[model samples]
Target: MTATAELVVDAGRRIAQDHPESPLAIAGLTVRYGDKPVLFGVDYATPPGAMLAIIGPNGAGKSTLIKAALGIVPKVTGEVTLFGRPQAQERHRIAYVPQRAGVDWDFPATVLDVVLMGLYREMGLWRFTGARHRKTALDCLERVGMRNFADRQIGQLSGGQQQRVFLARALAQDAELYVMDEPFAGVDAATERAIITVLKELNARGKTIICVHHDLATVAEYFTHVLIVNMHKIAEGPVAEAFTEANLQAAYGGRLSGAQVTRLAGASS
Candidate 1:
């Protein structure tokens, strides 16, 4: 077991003790890509002021589950409710930070410009970014500790910087629920720490966060709630309880194999 992995597992155990309750609920949710099925009857819930990490092997429908919950993808069955209301009816209260790679950074936009788009829902189509909007955007950037780079071109920033800008944009939305896809991918350790800190602060403020995570080693530390998924959900609950060897085995199929399990178990222990 690596020292870092042990620390992460220990931290997760502590965080689980601090918070308990599910704020977002999904029931029998299924998503399809064209005629092919991606998600199959998945169900999960996240506690208020809690961080939920969704993990699975490649092509496991992790992204599909998130997009389905947000109504960004076509669902074949089931329902998604945020804070007891249908997601569709609560769009303004939900924020999404897509994978940094999913966006085009060279689109000739500044960091501040992208963050300000978060207020477009409230500002409407024709209205310009008024003083209130600008102030809100700046405040959001400050919250993520990126106020200094507010005016920089997004393409000029590093991977972590780009991720922070997206987070700032999500913050400017003032959403009660946040759904982020792979926020830690390819980011530096400092940037990862910064992002985690911001998420913790937001969770403390009563915002629910769900992230599609790929790093299995940090899953226990970065999230309080864990959802093990494949084409279907294997387990969902407190990280300490739900992120068990059995659940992981189920989610990963035979891919984890014997050697991988030993490695992961040592790390998780």
Candidate 2:
């Protein structure tokens, strides 16, 4: 790791050295697709109750970082901890929202059915869902403004509506930590607003949100913490401190122009 690149591992450790019990802690995490390394020795820890945005250019492994931490993908090296415990033991406390495009929406399930899937872990797969369980599912949908569409087929909804339903499903888990892959990608303006509003409200209530976000313009407005990466971590900390011109240049390399960097810096400030 370069002196500059060491920021990838050290920045996260600096977040919580005295307390390794942060919401999520990753040490020396690495991923490789055969001989090609996707992530190289990334060390990161999420601040408790922070709405952190992990940002980087395409192919930066933003999604892979989260996936590896969540154990959705295999890790070539390093260890991941959630709430100071091994991930498998504490997985019940986590909620994950995968990329919208990855779901098979045509499976003849209603919006409510998808949200109820969140309860399968708690209710057991073959166990019947009682009225209370159904109520919890409805309340989750209501939180995301999808209660009216609960009976609608998942495949019939627009992209934004589908995103909202997924968000509701995550909410139904009642998890302490929510990790999402590009929650705002390709959504309409109103859906974006609704999503941000719900996320901020969750953060206010002490839920830790670690999201793989793409848009730099909304980093400051939507998140309190930022992690910039390009295979190796570039910068990470509270948004105001880490989302800077130098980090942007390092994370995106020559992809961002002087004017584009200037605009991002201005927005972040």
Q: Write the per-residue lDDT of candidate 2 for residues 152-222, one digit (tens) a residue.
A: 99999999999999999999999999999999999999999999999999999999999999988888899
How many clashing residue pairs appear in each of the predictions shown?
2, 0
> lDDT per prediction?
0.81, 0.89
- What is the per-residue lDDT of model 1 for residues 104-143, given as tens digits with 9 covering 90 to 100? 8998999999999898888876778888888889998998
Could you tell me how far off, in angstroms, the CA of residue 173 lies in candidate 2 after the best superposition? 0.2
Q: In lDDT terms, which candidate is top?
A: 2
* Lowest-sum lDDT 10-residue window in model 2: 10-19
TM-score of each: 0.87, 0.93
Q: How close is each model in CA RMSD to the real structure? A: 9.5, 3.5
Residue 35, candidate 1: alpha-carbon lDDT: 76
Worst 10 residues of 1 by lDDT: 12-21
